[model samples]
Target: MVIFLAETAQVLAQTPQSLKPAPDAEAGAQAYADNCARCHGPTGAGDGRDSKRMHPRPRKLSEGVFKFRTTASGTPPTDEDLYETISNGLPGSRMPDFQRLPEDVRWQLVYHVKSLSAAFQDKPEPLAFGKDPGKGANLAKGKELYTQLGCNACHGPQGRGNGPSAATLVDQWGDHIDAANLTQGWSYRSGSSPRDVLVRLMTGLDGTPMPSYAEAVKPEEVWDLAYYVHSIQAEPRWSSKVAAVREELGWDKAPRTDLRLSSTFYRNGEIVPSSVRAVSVQAMYNEKEILFRLTWHDRSESRETPSDAAAVVLLEDPNSRWRSGSLRGWTGKTEPAELLSYEDGEWTALLKRPLPSGKRAGLGVMVWDGGNAEQGRHRSNSNWMELILK
Candidate 1:
């Protein structure tokens, strides 16, 4: 009899319905006020005081325009969908996972979030996904389908989100939207498993241009496309060590290291994205000076009045402040010792500075794309990388 009771208790613990608390939006109101209102706003309008600086801004909950969902396109998400998102949070965005909260509290927050949208009044059910034939996924067939299905028009032939129409894409709200950089699996708005890719293919994102492939492809064929896309996902590379190789000849002989750059708004503490993605850097030092050569790709040559530009930022510590003017004497005179040139959609720059009196120094890189209207603090930057000078 004791053994039978133990088995029953285990089954009860595994049951989601048995574990969930009753909905309480009243209790949820205070929780949202305390945790969510700072970014989502008091009325869930997504106009919190902190929202202005955010790229791909917070969702206006009242409109019920969700990006991730299991429901049909243009339909409200199921309650379970809302619960899961509240629990796991949206990856690659400012929204963080709230799993630390008790399951009851999370459920209440879901209830409160749903109350903000009248579209959730009917409690829409999630669309059922068809069986996945992942074991039979064909890479060649998937690649063929990728072109036939016009996926290449927006996602590019190589699935790098650099297709012909990528620059022209926008969300339903008329805000500019970037296509998913397929090579980076972690950046996918929804989860990045084969199953996650399958679901997104079956049920299209509601607010974006990605459409449901349910009618366009056979149920089994969708698995082929999902597997092909998943296969292309490559692990992104990042380096913190900048080795200043002893090269008296020039930058061609310097050791090269690659660093991924991302658009960030320091004031709001957000890592938003812009056109510039990554930069390759080479560092070389002689007896008197060090030279850094930065190379990157930019689609447009934005050299208008507000010109496209790049800078090599030097600092002694994380708290080092800019004294305005130039770096002062490090590059000699009042002007910075930097030269930049662009050609055929590529930027190459050479920065010269005197050797600092330390074993290690903080170095950062910044880029500005005038064509994208990126300027001032609204530019792409790398985190301070440790420069090892021997």
Candidate 2:
């Protein structure tokens, strides 16, 4: 059987130049004003009104220092690099993808972005990359290089970005920098293929402490290291979270389905980046009712009535729309179906409701960390997941 390379590599290698929309800086300026001004500012200064609330705050585009680039350090990224960033956005950061915009508009924004700083005046080209040689790279060799190259110093022994030196690193402008969490490849700003990782290894992130390994490592060996890093990457499995409620014996002992949760955000699209990142869910049902048990970690315990609370919402139900009032503040006739408990920086919430006539329904969750001032709209949430009833 023939196997293809990763799609990310195909995106990088197969994007034809003829298909790109023409570069128009003036049009790009307008697009930037409409889409990016809230965080990046009108002049690309990274001083928008919402910048203060943002962690790892928006990039100061006027400075012309980019973190993800195929070019050598200290040079402006090529136009394609800028286009790719605009299209893909930084996953872990507040910079969201603009792929929804038209191709021409996105191309225009790239030129306008480059025009913000004088560094692009040189119009330098990106460095060339050889084909990935070590396909199923030697994990053992990669582990050795990861140590010999001192990647563990800042990225930790497990690539969790928790090394002893992680807390002390900063960018060129003295802003604090968090080492990339290598295990979460989905959050990688650059594409997460072996080829993509190879690029990062060869061309270090500019303006940050991550240095290029181009001079120190052999080409083949670096490919092996990249493959190993790729192997550690993980992402959430939304499908596995499907709560299949069966009428089996010992309903109370049903296996819990786990799903990861992420921080809530502002109405204007700013993510709060909270500490609560995961939750375990168990669902059981009888002829009369359905019960859901959700457990999650919270460092602080807030007993504030209805404040440090958790709620399970039936998102598809018109009565329990996401924009509805708080758990206790339900303006509708339906009563809130929630029970919560907290102990030792952990939360266990039991939410029960009558079984619907339908065979399947959508369920969602919202968590409030009152100690962290998470109330009202400021809370963690999960996307509506399918609950199968048998």
Candidate 3:
């Protein structure tokens, strides 16, 4: 009888998952609010107590995005992804996983993190940068002015979508977008419009890495970024084969025709190559919840991470700008080299998230050169952009 009782207790402990709530989302919420609110913010915006002093910035869960997960293409992070990040802090960032929390408790905390942005409701309010007449001519000046005004301080050099400050940046999900990749000109959560550009530049995306330019930049300079954004090609590189492989496209609505998404690079553009080029982006859904497929791989014909990246899903938001959110970035990298083959290995990232608005979104990717900045630039390999289309 004693032995049977002991065995039963062990089974109960091992089968804890059989119970509902797993780790108790409600409990996690309170614990997170008390312990993480200071830096992560009550809403998980990554602007907690010490956020201002920290380089780069804290993770903003309100954005409902995470960079270090799955593959280059955004997808739901795996248990290992969460565990590893939680167990070990990033190399050059303020983000530190809750090592003290029990395994089940950590899972509960993940649920709470996901809930931080429930109030965002990224409604399509129409972003207007409001370009004046000279706005057109100021593009070159905007490019130059971007440096003088410190826009590069946050955005990055040349605004090709990289910023030195981003190395330590973290989001609500403990991920980082690093640079905005302004050249893309498309809002991850908002539609890509001149006004959309202005709103982001002027007001800054309140909760996330983007801050209100009103405080840091002049109105005229904001116009310059708008102008430079136009002058700068935010578009990513696309090959006819890859373009035709699954018909990369984007639309005002969720698409599931013969075309499918192989992978997406939020801001693949970079002036310099690092240890590994990392990419990340948040997609906004135009319609209802939907599912898509994605992929990623090295151009050197080498598969570093996984033959298969990860899976992501989408859902229609009753209230959202794009109505969907997607994020993807590099967790680590090895060596780097120049362009090797025109046709090489291609790893896929499968989409499996809720499609909030599902209309538009921010997509990003990376190609690092072991921390070398110049290594990322490639005429044939550098710069990239694509969308889900028919």
Candidate 4:
């Protein structure tokens, strides 16, 4: 008896503690009415009274299409994925985190959410994601597959999300949604790891035009495509002196810093989030001159109506006050560095300023996409970034 008791204790010790409670559908239904019905609607059709006012709108739970998941896009996300989203909420959107709720309540909510869609009735198997195919060789093969797969139709030849079809695409809800700019891996709505790309390709974003490539491309080939997609990411440039010919600063040689603009700011008494979520920056300097190269994906080269443009603002005082809430510069009237910009599938700009001495200068970046109706103070901007001269 003693030996048996000891053995039972050992076995129990090895067992993993379950984070979820046995979900109660009844409890979930009540919780949904209390918490989710306002935005998701009573029927989960995404037709809540408030839905129409939101950009990208609330998801249609009945459709069982989720944007963020470790599973392939078409497949239902694992229960854990739903729970995480419910707990942490999606950034730059109206979704609010529910971490304050009890863990058991979250699991129950997941159960109720799944019940809204018949797709979750029978568990859908997740597609298999393969290993990374390294860099150079796979990138070449991936580039070939990119063309063969007709990715250029929506994502553009350079993965800038400016393909001809980009202008016409809409979500299931009839709202406009652009094909992802593959060059900015950091901005992927699902996740940005190589595995995330593979999953996106295999699963495709549900409820949107992005289709799964699981049948069209082999598993190994997906890795190649992912690697190739990663290769086109923009990088920063360094030079001992400012190049007399601007063309000399080839994009490939620049060191790159990719930034995500996920924070929403107040505009015209409403909360406005940046439609352009990511930007790449590179810098080069000589004894007297400094040049910054900035690039961001833009669906339309809006040179006429709204004119696409970018700027870099500098402040001598490191502690200069600039609030995202308002459009005031560090000082009341500091002029921005001179900016020259060009646009194709993407917007590229060169911001030149006199090199700072003594200490590093505080710099801020902003991009205006006229196609999105962004002009004047209404634009996507980043907080201050320090520029250290070496």
Predicted structure with the largest TM-score when compared to the true one? 1
Once fitted onto the true fold, the runs of candidate 2 whose alpha carbons sit more than 4 angstroms away are 1-23, 123-125, 134-136, 240-260, 265-270, 275-325, 328-379, 384-390
How does candidate 1 fare on TM-score?
Answer: 0.76
Inter-residue clash pairs, candidate 1 = none
Mind giving the per-residue lDDT tens digits that candidate 3 earns over 1-390?
A: 000101011001112345425557688888787667887888777777666534336667676554443212222333343444554444334565466777666666665765676432432222233446553556776777678767676555655444556556554344444555454433222323444455446655433565555556666667776657656544433321111112223422332211112212123231222222222222323244333433222222333432112322212222332433432322222222222222322333334344333333322233322222222222111122343312
Error of 2 at 152 (Å): 2.2
lDDT, candidate 1, equals: 0.70
163 Cα displacement, candidate 2 (Å): 2.1
Candidate 3 residue-wise lDDT at 101: 72
For model 3, the superposed segments whose C-alpha errors exceed 4 Å read: 1-131, 134-137, 172-174, 186-188, 234-239, 242-390
lDDT by residue for model 4 (1-390), tens: 000101011001111337567778889999888888888998899887666545668888988888765466567777766876787665445666687788789889988999999878666565556656655347778899999999999999888888889988999878777777777554445445566566668877778898888889888998988777767754423221222222355556556665544334554444555667666777777677767787777788666646666766665544554533344442221123333454547666777667666356666667776787732223676656665544
Q: How much lDDT does each candidate structure score?
A: 0.70, 0.69, 0.42, 0.66
Higher-scoring candidate on lDDT, 2 or 4: 2
Cα lDDT of candidate 2 equals 0.69
For each candidate in turn, give its C-alpha RMSD to the true structure in angstroms: 7.7, 7.0, 20.0, 9.3
What's model 2's TM-score? Answer: 0.70
Identify the runs in model 4 with alpha carbons over 4 angstroms from their true place.
1-20, 26-53, 67-81, 84-103, 122-125, 128-137, 230-270, 280-292, 322-344, 352-361, 374-378, 387-390
What digit string (tens of lDDT, one per residue) describes model 1 on residues 195-216?
Answer: 6787788788778898888788
Per-residue lDDT of 87 in model 4:
71
